[model samples]
Target chain A: MEEVASKVLSTKPTLFSYFRSSASWRVRLVLALKGIEFTYQAVNITKDGGAQQYSEDYAKMNPMNRVPALFIDGKCLGESIAIIEYLEETRPDTRKVFPSDPYLRAKARQLTEIINSGIQPLQNLEVLNKIEDELKGDRKEWAQHFIKKGMNAFEEIIKETRGKYCIGDEVSIADVCLIPQCFAAERFGVDLATFPNIKEIRDSLTGLPEFIAGDLKSQPDYVA
Target chain B: MEEVASKVLSTKPTLFSYFRSSASWRVRLVLALKGIEFTYQAVNITKDGGAQQYSEDYAKMNPMNRVPALFIDGKCLGESIAIIEYLEETRPDTRKVFPSDPYLRAKARQLTEIINSGIQPLQNLEVLNKIEDELKGDRKEWAQHFIKKGMNAFEEIIKETRGKYCIGDEVSIADVCLIPQCFAAERFGVDLATFPNIKEIRDSLTGLPEFIAGDLKSQPDYVA
Candidate 1:
């Protein structure tokens, strides 16, 4: 533990991310909450004709060909939720993203998965593009449907769990996941007004410096 | 910890599961691997006009209206990964599902997310049904495409990390997640021949009693 911690402490981190990618924003938020400064290496997933994430180098770093891959301790890690949990585990002393109580922690994770797996994956860029280009479907409607359905559940869960944040005032992984999904929700034209609880939670968290630092607009590669 | 564990130990668990739901099977595998006995309360997701999961009763337990909501310690928990993590944390003395080493644990989680978020969600029953019914898209083609794409990434990551299991000789959450996904992959007509590493690992793990016990065919609600 000491050896690994010392090695991690000595080396700065590098985040490979995209400005509008919700998953990328999740890792950025975690890094902000942890106060772990790192070099930001942007991977423009939408710019190139084929997307930079599909390039050989980026694919080598993340076989999933996705953004928000963290290069830390001389190793590359991908997957937003996994990277968030890794940060939480390694730096426990930092702002804790998980709850201290067992049930609350489980609830926080449950809420996080509502966004991570339930909402975000369904409306991700790859899925949306596939729906439009190949499936000849309305990508906007598809994204809105799933996002609204997920937010309905998320709103329900948070209504019982909220106290200023998703899990009783602490800024948990649930909150980290929520703010980005809400961004995607509005982009898809989903009416956030339908989910009052989610709207309230999003409003409360977006003003925090940690969340602000992770906002899509504050990103290094932001366009428009 | 003692208070929670004692409460948990005093009461037997009840798993609300579907016969072939990949997410539900994940929690079953964890419970089996941990040697925890739980009552199987089958919630048929396919029966009647609407799935039982969407019923008012089940929705009260899990607003997501998903199967495999584990009722344990006097609380209902949803999200298979969250339930798995809760079990791991609350019962550390049981047969471990996460790797002890920090980095290995992260890798295990990364691989799990590759399936949990990347692959499974894309090919899930709801997504497939939606593609077929509303979008008029070829659901099988959609499932096959996402499953194969995700398997390609899953195979790539495990190649660097595999050693009898996803992270090492011991079975980890990665392996638990992989087995169910392979089940879905085969169902979607994804040839296991392409992902030999995943196939090999899946083959090695399925013969174990714990996995077999969690097999869809082993479920109370299994049809065929």
Candidate 2:
């Protein structure tokens, strides 16, 4: 920790995140895997009606008012995928989010999208509240439904693409998205028994030290 | 049409699209801006419960079962942001989806996410149907609400980011996501008068011949 902190002494990146945020976890996994040092600034999304994210000061940095905004390279970056990609582009390392081949890169990205755009937003905290309060729908059940449906597709993609990871041998962005989403799914009581492919890949990823460190319960701000 | 066909003799891209699909339109804008020739295959998402996107054949190509899956470089790509980034990466030319600078690239992508994930999925056809059939909510009102909220954020981002286009004088992927989202918002009865910055940027992009060619009514599959 001392050595890593010394290396990142100049303008250390600060990640504004919430402990339970799946998107923040995605960025955390990437930063960990890339071996980049960053400071974690916990933004409690459950407090003050998520007012921390929407406060005038925070909104100026990320107009979307979402956590997991990375302050790096002298600018603030919002959106987990965007922040990860920016890190990948600016700070290139041995491990990459996308592979070298264009087709394989597309494959990794396709999987990233399956979670980033396809599944996550439908079951985001805000959307779930809308379902429960305004729509009078069971938020948990609605979340379970989308997670199951998306996991089905994700498992199929994993079945076809997996080797040591979600796409071939490397740990691409797909694995980063997969781990957090599975965590979110389980929280909503989604049955992962049928998604053996996703389970297998996730089992492999979550075992890694970096993956373990980035888990929801392991964060500095996490509470029972 | 014949001349355009002749120009793209070998390995022309096939874009699975629907005339009114905002996600599909997003990819369309990028292909057009980059002058990358592609054949359009309309997968009528509004017909037969979006079955065309879910067909075994299409699912094999894109497991997420969404349109704007680009069959290019001998592979299929889904998710508009991912597809556009792939194109930007592979088809490196003077016309790029993001600017040359890394920070600027992050800025472009931040706007892209602001629309791609923030707004579109909230007002997606499936979500709208869910709002109506399951939630017993007025779809139009719901669409308007989300779109307006997102656009307000979008307008702020645009105000800070815009030059001649969304990011700068050059057209970017931010513009690509912006045009389609504004188009979708208007369709859902979202009045654009409040979004002067977005309206101005859309006005500039829509005036170009390439952008005009990518309009909803101009696509080969348009009806009514």
Candidate 3:
């Protein structure tokens, strides 16, 4: 069994990620939650047509050339939510990140999508950059407007099903998505006071060592 | 076994859906795929401040006031992708919409997210309405720009990993997402010739009886 396992896990997995990407943060959280050992390979996306876009090696790994691509054993996986769910299905014993009950699982995934699809994408670095460059909107104003509107919608959803976490007292995938989005919101100077539930959840999760370890400030690429 | 099964399947499910929402379309696809019958409770989102905003009952089901909320056996589920995944898990035999292999499953999910997070949200009716009402841009030009850009990205992603279907030869959740997005793009006058892979897949799927049955054209509230 050990020999078979060694062959399966032959090559060490490396995560091509950035410190500030919300998508990367979600994958990092999943790695910590699942106790999966992997190397954190940082790609500084702000330099030279973006590191992920220009690097020949990274392009080979992910043709989409997006950050948060996981090179595991010899295969590459892109998309943060998909990568995390892959981990959940394969490593169920490390910790069950998803609820067993289908209804509860749906509720958890719904909240996760609210953050992933609704909030994170609108406030992404690329989108903000586009608005700044193409639309000639002030970067600061564009970030603030999108963040505030997205956070307002997130707050309404959070209020509906939140308990100790984003979904009924469990530290599921929804919490992983929430923290990074809130981090992005704060970076844009969006006030969290108006969203009591969001603030409370963010505060609670930040206190955990697992979440703290996954913070952008603690990543290998952290400048400060 | 029949007694236990009847107890489990006794309750009717409710779905909080909008007349012509792509997200709602995704949930409807899942219901059809799973062979799970549901009560279609329409939330007319274009009249009298939008049914989602004013309907107290709908608000209680999904505080976010988004459509495609599913009430299964008296419990409400929201987020279209999540609801679909929930149906897949509970009714695994009806039609296996997700692959069992973790990596393949992740790829399928990644394709779905590309549609959900990357494409659909940007081209949503509400977002377009807001751009027209608040941003004071030429609505047609803005719509054209976003639809083209988003479809371009979708086409590139699909070209990379698709086979007979989105992920493999089988019909997965990604196909469910792709068809509706293509439907919306055509409505917005996006030139499909530029995206051969997308056009081919869309045309092939649209020809299928299952897809045709689930199409927006077949819905009760379809305008055309």
Candidate 4:
């Protein structure tokens, strides 16, 4: 089934992505959930002396020099949230990733923004590199401090708004954001048990076929 | 006309805010644009020895312990983005701050998120305070560096997507975000002339009645 999905997706639109990138993981989950076929064009950001920076072609596709650029119907869109939303709008026949009620949609978007803004940038590879190179701090300790702070905030946010999903009983864009952040948190040894709400949401999300298939460990380039 | 709008709005809701906060400024712009009346319940975050730390009542409304919490129709919403979006949804008849097309809407939101997540947090008071007290840096220099970096990125983003507005010819949520951030940038003396697109948008936005009313100088607590 996994092979078939990959093959079919490969024949459709293509996503230029890195397997380990949380932003790319978000777009992948949306594609899987929507059941939309799309090709995964892997650009290993870590290899060949940083593929994203060295590739002239990729830079043209995304001037911001970020991963998870999508090429659909010959037009390219950068920024993971923008790409996901484009997919959501273009393929409305698939499951709706955003809620219908404007207020609820805003709530869902707010949750996604919190993770995107509050947590991800703080622990991004570039920022961590700065801490190690310029600040002269133990990389592990700095990463641990931010990851813990972010997760604590995530726990509070989840407790306030979650139900069967991040906003309520429905899986919206918020869930797509939650999973990857959780993956990053666990890698930093932040202890998922401390955030029961986040753990429960992660558990529920992992059980879904879409999420399971989108897992970094399940990707073609999975190292470990 | 401005007085009447303010009077009508003042009767509709109450906002818990800090005078110098960009997040608070974002909500204030939304309220003014929507023509909603509200009272400003000032929480001088820095006055008389850190008032926000002692405001347990405010914490109940927002577990995140952030400012610009809105109480509307007896319901409280935290997060400035969340509150502005809620107002847009609940009062769609007033004025539509979000675009109807999903792609455009997503693009506008992407700009908003980039500022909210990518730029704002890097220059936030809390983060700057941490850098000063804990990292032992010149607070003024550190603030200027981060604010300039964030604004430069923002200028590039605006140049790419902007039309008559941040996303297009219409004023959307992105403008609400842009105004406050520009104000913050000016406060840090980052030289707006360096960013022509941002300068143009700022010029256009300041001419509008709603934005003018939301200006920090026009607020009830304006020092000048």
Candidate number achieving the greatest lDDT relative to the actual structure: 1
State which candidate, 1 or 3, has the greater TM-score.
Answer: 1
What TM-score does candidate 1 get on C-alpha atoms? 0.95
Candidate 1 stretches with Cα past 4 Å from truth are: A1-10, B1-10
What is each candidate's DockQ, to 2 decimals?
0.72, 0.70, 0.47, 0.37
Q: Which ten residues in a row have the lowest lDDT in candidate 3 chain B?
A: B1-10
lDDT values, one for every candidate: 0.87, 0.83, 0.75, 0.74
DockQ of 1: 0.72
Ranking by DockQ: 1, 2, 3, 4
Taking all chains together, the TM-score of candidate 4 against the true structure is 0.85
Q: What is the lDDT of residue B64 in candidate 4?
A: 56
Residue pairs whose backbone atoms clash in candidate 4: A9-A38, B9-B36, B9-B37, B9-B38, B10-B37, B10-B38
Model 3: residues >4 Å from true position, as ranges? A1-10, A54-57, A138-153, A156-160, B1-10, B49-51, B138-161
Total backbone collisions for each predicted model? 0, 0, 0, 6
- Residues A140-181 of candidate 1 have per-residue lDDT tens digits of 999988888888898888888999988998898999899988
Clashing pairs in 2: none
Q: What number of backbone clashes does candidate 1 have, counting pairs of residues 3 or more apart or in separate chains?
A: 0
Chain B TM-score, candidates in order: 0.94, 0.92, 0.88, 0.89
Task: State how far residue A138 of model 1 sits from its true place (Å).
Answer: 1.0
What digit string (tens of lDDT, one per residue) describes model 4 on residues B64-182? 56677777755667778778878876886887888887766776766676677667776777666755676665556655765666566566666767898787778888899988888
